[model samples]
Target: MRVRPMLLKAGGVFVLLVLASCTLSGCWDRIEVNDLATITAVGIDQYSDNLIELSLQIYTPPQGSSISMQGGGSKGSSSQNQSTVISATGINFADAVSKVQEKVPRLLFWGQNEVFVFSHSAAKQDIAGHMDYILRVPQIRGSALVFVSRTKAKDVLALTPQLRSSSADVLEEVSNLKIGLAMSAGNFNIMLSSSKGTAIMPSIEIMPAPEGQPQKRYPAITGCAVFKDSKLAGYIDDNITRGVMWFRNEIDMATATIVTEDQGGIISARLNRGRTRLKPRISNGIWEMTVGIDTREILVQNTSNTDVAELKGTRIVEEGLKQEIEKRMNRTLQIVQKKFEADVFGFAEAFHRKYPKIWNKEKGNWEEIFPHVQVKYDIKTVIVNPGKRTVPTNRMEGEKG
Candidate 1:
């Protein structure tokens, strides 16, 4: 009888332990997705001397339906509006965010934000200061793409995109294409924090509406903002930005069109591959840098009489490609290295890697020496494919006629 009583007490204790496990596993503080306002994009602009304005593009679902919080939806749909923009002003980014939260009825959630745009004025004022607030917010993504807007960042956010769900969606896709300089907030911060203290950000501008389509204006990556000492030094236009990309070894796709002076016609070549190397040398206490470019291009369109099958004709096209690349790079160097005097090309880092001791002594005066650094280009371009036709179609057609 005593043994039977002990067994019954142990069984009751086992049941009690199972009940406690269920209670511990319950999600008591879980936030419902329906109650959170998902932020898809954010913009920061200077409101006044001490005030900063924050704009958020929030994703709003259809009125009656509750969708999963996975941020999946058709973009640029003609049927329903998917998002809304809200703005608030405060002393700093954090304070402005708090003000924005007050205006929003639902809790502002930044987990889905994909793009961050800063107005040119705001960038020039103090981007590094603003960047601190951005990184400190644990909810925001460090991988979010960043851009500089020529006008108010909020205006860029407000533009109605015809092909995308929102302006942020449009920006995210374009920046990924790498046609212009694409930088994530994390990499941007690293660049600013580097010893060289130089960085570059893609610049966006509102393009004119297409003919008879006044409501279809959209933002475009038209140039780049060059920063020196954590401040906006100047900008490089689209053409010059391509050269910058080449020097940075970031060029993935490009088209080179050159006028064949001897043939009196035009030839356009598509770059299949491009590589750049920076060789820094110190001879007799003189710093000289050589930019070596190795590229393979395919002839896409040729109105010239140059024959791709013939060795002599191929050399002509190759020579033209080399000169064209040199021209673009020289123009870029003229503006960025000489005019802006901004070391956006990582020359300081390159020198440091090659000559550490000398760099330690010379880095303090790098800004003064950067403009005077001698640069030479050793470019070699080869025509990998001349397309299906060995000779110009136009020339062949004329010859037959």
Candidate 2:
């Protein structure tokens, strides 16, 4: 009995030592930072009918004690030109990536990449196919911003940014401002998988250089690319993109400028906040959607002679603003809804939420029903502030003490 107890204790001690040793062993596949070629952005283009080209913008760290200060720095400043572009062509996204890896001496790392630019031709070919590899790859982040370039994406990546560290940095800043349509990789996938299978991505193009200043060029977001059935349908200009933002409830910062009828002067108002609601109803088997917009704006500039201090004058200005907004929205609807037949405004999702069983039975017919769906708008705008000046500068003489 004594021998048996001693033997059991020895076995338990051996097992405990083995478990402790396993815990002390760190990751077996750890990669060193020095061996990594960290990518900041990725650009995709169609090289040929069946070949795909992939470009990577990799970050280059500043060489020994050469950090450039913003106020004054040498032409060889580290902050100015820190990224380099490398490209390779392959049969598909994965194959292209492998080719790029073979060319690069260091191991390609993707954790820092936050921007993906697709050329118009590549996007038209089938963006969803590219997105499939992106979604499955564990290294690529889901929140990466996606953009469609008016020109070749590789060219866009090659252009150096004047303000930011790299082209990717500039694109990320633009997306953060919400100046136009900004779609994330995951959100785009969700949109494509939605009931109607429609999506939109911001469009970027190189800004035209001024005469005699060919070097002053940069990528700018000018519009949006519409996608239907996982293919590029068409594009919408900036003005129409704003209207789309209103319909999608994605408006963050907006300026509505209108020419007042009373004074024939322009007045610009900045949106303080805005909300949109979509109400779906079925009447006699007819699908109808009512869009309600409630917004508050502050007058930023009043070049009109109208006395906005008075109640009557304020109402008139508000009416003009309302009309301006409606005009843009109507134009957008005409092109996106009636012409392109794209349900990018989430109308299908709204209807499905409202009527689940009916949606399930009729989801397949959403594309047919979308273009003809009756849409009514209820827009209400409140002028929260008329700025520090109650009366316009031109109408100061007409003000009473």
Q: Per-candidate TM vs. native?
A: 0.92, 0.90
lDDT of 2 by residue, 74-146 (tens): 5665545678899999988999999999999899999989999999989999798899999999989989999
Clashes of each: 2, 0
Once model 1 is optimally superposed onto the true structure by TM-score, how far is the C-alpha of residue 167 displaced, in angstroms?
0.8
Model 1 regions more than 4 Å off = 1-29, 65-78, 397-401
Overall local distance difference test of candidate 1? 0.88
**lDDT string, candidate 1, 8-32, tens digits:** 9999999999988999875997678
Q: What TM-score does candidate 1 reach?
A: 0.92
